[model samples]
Target: MAPFLKEFFPDVYKKQSEIKDSSNQYCKFNSATLTMFTSSLYLAALLASCVASYITKAWGRKISMLTGGITFCVGALLNGAALSVWMLIVGVDL
Candidate 1:
């Protein structure tokens, strides 16, 4: 399996362990439902990301990057300080 996968997609195979670690951590944080909900939100965010990319195209890369960084920091703080699982979900959306 290793030989077959590496022959086809070495970079993807190399990242398998990290993917597993992320999956394990995701499961530990919440139940399966929450994980699925979060994944759906992530997909939604990816679609939103395309809009963001277009909106920021004329705004300058540095400014857009900083805005995204700040938004992520705010989200992390809310998630870390959440009082309930629902709040955590809302925070993750931020």
Candidate 2:
């Protein structure tokens, strides 16, 4: 079971190096900085997910879903408008 899980999620183990390469391709940064930036962005998204989940509970499932849909749209627009890493970060924050 353990081996099967590990094989199935090999990307999970290799994701950091892959991401570091991708980040370097997209932006001028060292691996360490890239890791921090990616981690920060992930943290932001996780927080957003938590907030959305809570709001969904308070506002009803439909309303929460609608809000999440809008957030997804905004995120796509941000990606399209991204000129730099900072823009990407700001877009995700939005």
Best by TM-score: 2
After superposing candidate 2 on the true structure, give the runs of residues whose Cα lies further than 4 Å from its correct spot: 1-29
lDDT of 2 by residue, 23-88 (tens): 355433334544654676788788888898899889998998888889879987986777665666
Query: After best superposition, candidate 1 residue 8: deviation in angstroms?
Result: 40
Candidate 2 residue pairs that clash: none
Clashing pairs in 1: none
RMSD in order of candidates: 12.5, 11.3
Supply the global lDDT for candidate 2: 0.65
Candidate 1, residue 45: CA error in Å? 3.2
Best candidate according to lDDT:
2
Query: Residue-wise lDDT of candidate 1 within 1-94, one digit each (tens)?
Result: 6753354345545656346456354333333544554585787488669867875888977887888788788878986786555556666676
Q: How far is candidate 2 from the true structure (C-alpha RMSD, Å)?
A: 11.3
- Clash number for model 1? 0
